[model samples]
Target chain A: MSGQQSTTSTSIGSRLLDWSLRGYVVLVFVFIFAPILFSVVFSFNSARFPTIPLESFTLHWYQTIWNDPDVWTAVRNSLIVSVCTALIATLLGFCTAYTDYRYNFRFKSAYLALVLLPPTIPLIIMALAMLAWFSKIGASGQLWSIIIAHSVLTAPFAMAIIRLRLNQMDRDLESAAWNLGASEWRTMREVIVPFCKPAIVSALFLTAAVSFDEFAISWFVSGLNKTVPVLILEIVQGNIDPQVNAIGTFVFLVSMTLVIVAQIFFTFRAGKSFS
Target chain B: MARTNFSGFATTWRMPIIVWQVLFFLGPLLFMIAMSFFLVKNYRMVEAFELKNWEKMLTRGYFWDSYILTFWLASLTTAVTSLLAFPASFALAFKVSPSVRRWALFFLIIPFFTSYLVRIFSWYVILAESGVVNALLAHIGLGPYTMLNTKFGTLVGYMTLTLPLVVVLQTFALANIDRNLVQAAHNLGCSPARAIYAVIVPLAKTGLIVAALFCFILSFGDFVSPYYLGGSKPPTLPILIIDTTKSGQQWPRAAVVAVVMMLTLISIAFAALALAYRKRASR
Candidate 1:
């Protein structure tokens, strides 16, 4: 009876320890996320100073963010860049993945490596390199320069996703189409493209998210013209205002909404594909 | 004639793709390499090649110090992130219900969606002297320590950015482990801790390595965290390169530093990839 009681007490003690560890993990999660949460909550604060104690909640910062021309312009620029980057990256990624997967060619490994290199390269280095290259030919600080840089940075991710989707596809379908006297172009358009459309869409959304959130590359490449990230830097460097929190809150909402939507779409398609 | 026609069509189609790959991707790298070797006068690569830039870069005491500091920061970030992320990932993978796990993963990934700059800005509100941590510290009767403009601030900022990645990757790795192997170990009179250590860890070692490598690379290459959080004297190669570039008098020397940083990064990446590939092959 004594031994059993001791064993029971030991088990209870270990269980308590396990629970405390779990609690610690949860606390760490809060530590990681609390800043963003504070930003979101404090965006509604009436006070101008972001760090001041909370007064009555107000929507004034949101109003200010809405009325600010520079904020809107930055948002518009980010939207334009992200959309263009997504479209170009997705199209190029599709073509590359299709060509590589369909045709057995020499120098395949080298080509793949070249395509994969940019995403893994340090962003600052790539940014500096792009700056140097563009400036040498006298093309720095242009909107199109930013667009091209974003495309280059995001295309590899698109290619990787599309490649994975393509690998899962059966080559026999393409061969059968060709055997039926269908032209290669027709087969790709009708069969391969349709099969990879879901992945292509996911790639577009993912690339857009990445391009929109990108700062290091954009900071170097964006001269004169400021994106949202650049604007955030300017705000933090210059002022400690509540409007920045409001803007951050809006950005957080938009990005999270889009990611959630994309994830749902991806999950549904992935499930269907597997089923 | 028919065989020749087919081959000709294939060649024509492949040519543009190859050209795009070379011009857009390989061209910049080659240009960077060449510029690393050439002297820059008035922001243009001079006709004469010189080892002066390399020599100057090698001799700079600050350059070597920043490199060491950068590596140390990255190693610390990787260690902290892995230590924190491992248990969290294990909990999500094995302990949590599937529905809760889904929601947890979603929450973990939400920060990744926000602008990196904005997220870093948010940290200022949390770590500043008058910030959240300090406020809490004061409430508890502890003196409020300044976190911003210090190495601790930089470390915390880096941890915030990288911890999510470690958790996500480790969770994916742990989820992929064969459950039966773990169960078999437990059934064979092995304690849960012993089972995890012997069977689960060895199986998940590759994923952990990859996660650590990702954190290391990201932290090593990071300039913004230190720039924003480290106040006046940030010790990082990227910041050093930026400062050198802005000086306008040391273009060639800056290029040499950039080259060295790139080479170090590439070798590390190459080694990690080789290790990952070897592990995958063995599996």
Candidate 2:
């Protein structure tokens, strides 16, 4: 009888623990995702005040965001910066990574560390330094200034990713191509580039995303021309518009799509590589 | 002939990379360090070196208070994030199926994709007086707490931004743990808690430390959360730097603060890297 009683109590305790753990997981999930869900819901809120109960669902806010010239300008600026940054960073990164992988050089580790340094430093410091540098050279607040700043900040990430890809590549293929009377450029273009294409693509998308979302460096370097983040800041500071929610929703959707696409590409490439 | 070919190819590519690094990376850093030593008089950086900016920045009571506040907030955020992430990571790593883990990983990536500012703004809507939390509080017959522009608000903002990173890193760490060790512990007649504590924890120590370091650095360097949420009492160091720069365009003061922050951050990173290396070497 005593054994039965003890077993019953032990089972109860275990059940309670299991329930508590489940509850903990649910609570954490809610905490992490609630704001995103809230943002999505409030975007459709017909009420002028974002904090108020939803009076009705309407597409008015979305229309407003679509029609806003400032929003378009910000988006345009973001795209231009991202595209330019992506191209420059990827090219530079490819060159650097290729050089590093193919050669045994002095201060290799130091060079790698140097590439990683900007990411390590506080963004504000980089922004301020760029601002000072640009001002001294009479190039502050220009679009080119922002582009250069973004490239400098993002090239390291591109290099790291591409270098990882390069390290894993079969060097024998390149040597064989070279032995087959292929020029160095031909070997790189035909043999190496195709192999490193996936990482290169990943680096491109990642750099674009990073440059698009960059605020601190953009904030300093963008003198007259504001990026989306800076524009969002201005709007928020000025007024809490339902339109801001619309804009936020749009950004969230676009960014989500980009990330999903990138992940799909990454996973597909990763699987292919593994197989 | 082969060696010379490789060397020739390397020389052609190497110079440009070197030039790029010197001009873009090292050059800016050296310039910033130099600016930190100069005197800024009447909104211009004077050529003469002066220690006044450093002394002023270091000696200010406000600077010390901000530093303390920033450190406390960062520590708090790291602790809270770790607490929330560890179990979720464990479940994802051990309990969930691979398909479910993939989905969970996708969900984890969502927060990162959203614009950072938008994420912060979303919190404002949730925590404001008229926000959902206060509405729920009111429904429960409790006082409606205004969370915006408060320290608590700042903490919440920081946690939301950084928790995903913690979860992802911890998941990566937990996934890498050897399964046989867990079974071995179980076969040895150890309780589940003891098995985890003795076997799994030791194996995951490096990952956990890395996650902690990542969280700490991210939180420490972040200025946006404090700016949007931290109201009248104290601002984070980055905000302070911005305010100082805006007032007089004091390059020296700004540079000093930047240098101090850089040194502190570098030291922390070095220490963490050393710990990681030591951990790896031990294995």
Who wins the lDDT comparison? 2
Model 1 clash pairs are: none
**Worst window of 10 by summed lDDT in candidate 1 chain A:** A266-275
On TM-score, the leading prediction is: 2
Interface RMSD after interface superposition, model 1: 2.7
Q: Give DockQ: model 2.
A: 0.50
For each candidate, what is the lDDT? Answer: 0.77, 0.79
CA shift of B244, model 1, Å: 1.9
Candidates' chain B TM-scores in the order shown: 0.88, 0.91
The parts of candidate 2 lying over 4 Å away from their true place are: A1-26, A273-275, B1-5, B11-17, B277-283
Q: Report the C-alpha lDDT of model 1 over A1-275, residue by residue, as the tens digit.
A: 24456579767875775677677669868977787888888898876655546678899999998999999989998888889988988777777787687778778888777777787677877777777777766787877778888888878788877888888887688898889988766777788888887788888887888888887767777887788877887788787777888888887777776677666655568456522
lDDT of 1 by residue, B96-127 (tens): 67887787787787777676677777787777
Q: What is the TM-score of chain B in candidate 2?
A: 0.91
**Model 2, A244-269: lDDT tens per residue?**
78888877777676566666655568
